[model samples]
Target: MKKFCFAVLSAVMLFGFAHTSFAEDMSPKDIMIKNFFVNRVKDSKSESAMTLINESGQKRERKSTGVSKLQKNGIDNMRLIKFISPADVKGTSNLMIEHSDGDDDIWIYLPALKKVRRLVSSNKGDSFVGSDFSYADVIGYKVQDFEHKITGSENVDGVDCYVIESVPANNKVRQDNGLSKRKSWMRKDNFVTVKGENYDLSGELYKVFKASDIQFVDKENNKWQPMTIEMTNVQVNHKTIVHFSNYKVNTGIDEGYFSQRNLERE
Candidate 1:
């Protein structure tokens, strides 16, 4: 029984290696989106810094406490709470995640209203809180949602980066669901997604995310670590940006942190 179990596990791992990544053979989009959604995070209490700008020339910033739970079945459920201004989002929680199966769900809890609101919209490209970035871009995506093809590699800011294009699949289940298209640039050496371009409903370039300051936080090895990440909406005139800082990767946050009860609380 043990040998049989090992055989099955080995085969499964091999299959994932084939379809998911053998980085050397990985398509740029495959490498990028995979890491964005399924990369294991540091297990610990982490925090993030967010900056928001709007078309009206107004800017607001907030800091949040983050807890990440990576499930065995290729799912990452993350909860973020705004801690800076209590009244602003006090007791509010945002559920950001990606699942191996099913459409990704983004939910927000409003403290004032004491309501949990699902952020789904008829338009998946809608801006998040008026920021230049759509809510879809911030959350990672399922690997099966799109067709991945390697477009080649090029030097991006002096780093050898893999470039891949992503297009929605034609399967009837996902046809015309509002995410038109996207492109990604993944660094070759570290396998980290450095930048991404989001297309509008009409397949027009609209936003980009740039990642940087990648340093090994726990340093057990290079595979798991935290890095500062920043995203800007370029076609929206570069008027908006979101920044991440003080990132502690692989701190091994408890899985219990992701329970539905906690999702409803502070």
Candidate 2:
């Protein structure tokens, strides 16, 4: 009887192993697409605190309110951010409209200038408001613009993750983002990126990203969101820590709220 029980256990274990292996056989592009879909929210509103620390330990903090809504076509996201704290940056705002097939639209309003300006540049790698994060970091890289391959698998914070390496498909794409390649450790279960390393044109590590404090934002949908995200510039020794709070999902935000006219509205 003991021998029979052992045989059954071994068969179950073998079946489980095969199932896991089959799931992991997905291509890199498929994995990225899955990750993108898993992270997408219908609409969300939140307030966040961004702290920037320099090499010398000097610190600056900015508080902002953000709103994001998915477009009706379900292929784009419109986001607006309004700075509210620190007298120097108060009343400043930025709007980004990310599209599925083309370059994203970006606009900025500076209180000091008292004018709204549209940003039109080929370089999407520029630092965002003097923070370690770049424009690409905010809007995300388009999956179709790059080539992806699974390099290996590893454990991150006790979670199993698939390591994916992404490279631009052409010189134009590489020039636009100012990145030669990027490697990300995506959690196997949820497809969330837990860690990432960005390489520059010279193939040197430029920045590192880490996500933590994950929490369920929509239990019914089995949706998870990260409460804290950190990016560090390796060469400059600068770091930006973003903490999100007061998250409300599926808020039914008006599409017109993402317009440039609304960007300048008080």
Candidate 3:
């Protein structure tokens, strides 16, 4: 039984590799599908510094640790992030579990509250830990939930990229992500997104996102990670920048480590 299971797993992994290997003359949806799993490493852990800047140029910084692992199916991902700095926000943690149906389950543990609160779907658009990134952004939008089209092509920092525009397939998806439309600039070389424009619920430009300092964490699997990410809310003149360090992948992190018990623990 074990041997058969192992063989099946190997074939699945090979299929995934083959899917991305032959990428020439692909469609817009094909590109989006490849982008979705571009960095789906088996497991990873990293330390991060998050900075939030307000309209008046005031800044609030916090440190955090994050860990993520792929589920048995090798598609959905489970992630947990815990704050580790600045007296006020310390000991706060968030847990996110991706669902196959495009609806993710999220929970947050606040130190002061001493209880875990489940984040409902309605709150998916709310800011994450007061940062410009929303809960849905943290969890990511499933490819099937949106209709993707190749809008155009452009060069970002000398690298050729494809500008893909995505719109919600239905009202539920739009409300869930609080986004009417999104445009992403993905590199032709690696399919990594370097820039994005997010339109608000009213179909007005709202946030601009930029990613830099890409690192190949899993070279064997062609996995890339962005060391720095910035999201700016143009409407409010506020922004958030997150820098990740000490990033490690495929460390054999135990699945149990992503449980609520660990998220709530100080």
Could you say which candidate leads in TM-score? 3
Model 1 lDDT tens row, 129-234: 5555555554555455677777888888899987878887763323334556778787777667777776756677767777776555544534543255656666
TM per candidate: 0.76, 0.89, 0.92
* Local accuracy of candidate 2 as per-residue lDDT tens digits, 14-110: 3443344357577787777666655568889999999999999999999999999887655468999999988898999999998664678899998
Model 3: per-residue lDDT, tens digit, 31-140?
A: 87677778889999999999999999999999999999998867689999999998899999989998754457888899998999988855677889889998877777
- Candidate 2 — which pairs collide? none
| TM-score, candidate number 1 | 0.76
lDDT of each: 0.60, 0.84, 0.87
Q: How much is 161 displaced in model 3, in angstroms?
A: 0.3
Segments of candidate 1 deviating more than 4 angstroms: 1-15, 18-23, 27-38, 42-44, 55-57, 119-124, 171-177, 218-221, 224-226
Stretches of candidate 2 off by over 4 Å are 1-24
The candidate scoring highest on lDDT is: 3
| Candidate 1 vs 2: which has more lDDT | 2
